[model samples]
Target: MGGAMKIVLIDSNARAVSSEDREVSVGSLTRLLGSKPAVTARLPNGDRLLTAKEPCVDNGFTIGRSRVVVGAGVVVGKRDAVGAYTPPKTNVDTLTKLVRWVAPDNMPRESEDGRTMVTAILVDPETRDIRQVSLRSDAGSLDGAVGGRCRFMMRVTTADAVFVKVGIGPRAAWRKDGLVFPGRSLIVGCSRYGTLVDVATDIASLRASVEFKSPDAPDWLPPSR
Candidate 1:
């Protein structure tokens, strides 16, 4: 029906190992390579699938002059025949993008406990004051944090108008923990606001004045007779 799909196998040093141009599908490619292929990178025309016998290795191939040490032998070909392709917009990837958007000058760091933290420099649009705050979240990896937290922080520091509400309920009245709201709440709340700027700024003036109180504080407790 169409031109036969072609695949090129390259070694760790970007040397061409072999080429196969025939009736190629993901199943056939897997049988030929003897392992499930993992897409290590995406090119303009196709994707690079890791086909090395030892997928985990120090040495790797180069895409132009840049060395990509993610895997050993890699199969380069069109992704049409590959199995369900996962877009690069995974939670971790999104988190990374948002982190960069909110904190262009700082890089995200990973803690030993596997949380990602980024320092966002917020600028007040009114008085032009600047404040730096650490945003942390867990996305199950060291590469980035969850998108939810980053998105919340993004709105808090960027939105021209942001509204925040705090409420408390009896532990027995709530299905989940009543002491604190789930982190997802922030994500849902911020979803209503669209991104307006990249750099973090306290345009709302609330960031610099907000205070956190312990749950044990008398005012936080419900009034009793």
Candidate 2:
């Protein structure tokens, strides 16, 4: 069974203009709000705060003591939908589980006493989830491949890594590898010795790139193109 649903149209000052009980559905809410609604917040009590997906300053309203500007915002309960309440679809935080690395068979080998290190930056094209992973090879072996996972699924459009170090101690040095895999989707594999490999995938692609930032350079210096 579905829970009772309520819709309230508020102004920029957070005052409710009209409040009523209604069956929750995208179409019904869109028609009432005069625009597509976006879930802005998930309340502690399982209620959701929804507002126009795009800014609607003309019909803006403020809510709470914080005065959040929720233009045409609507509040609904968890089970307010026609059937069961289904949360809004979001790429953010989706598939956030750890992804294992697909190491190459011919990964570079290091000396028995030496250690290999690699730093990889991975981004999900769809969610724009950026993650940094550090991998270290066991002493004397080239099998230091680690997986990558997103700590925070941000809406960042771009990411850059300057001064990437790959290799064993003393032998570890910076490399200039700027690569972008746009449009095409691919999985990433990193060798213990800091080599990056790409495998094409059908659904989504990852972007990998590296730039050298001199140790002596000032912190404020922008990365070289």
lDDT of 2 by residue, 1-225 (tens): 233454544433333344566656777777656678777766555666677676544433223311233355665556544555634322212211211222234232333544333344433332334455443322211122212211221212222212221322332112223343331111233322223322222112222232223334433222232
lDDT per residue (tens digit) for residues 133-182 in model 1? 44442222111222222222223322232211222442111011223321
Specify the highest-lDDT model's number: 2
Q: Which regions of candidate 1 fall more than 4 Å away from where they truly are?
A: 1-4, 22-28, 31-34, 46-58, 65-67, 70-225
Please give the CA lDDT of all the candidate structures. 0.34, 0.37
Question: For each candidate, C-alpha RMSD in Å?
Answer: 14.5, 18.2
Q: By TM-score, how accurate is candidate 2?
A: 0.30
What is the Cα-based lDDT of residue 172 in candidate 1? 16
Clashing pairs in 1: 123-201
Clashing residue pairs in all predictions, respectively, total 1, 11
The window of 10 residues in a row where model 1 has the poorest summed lDDT is 188-197
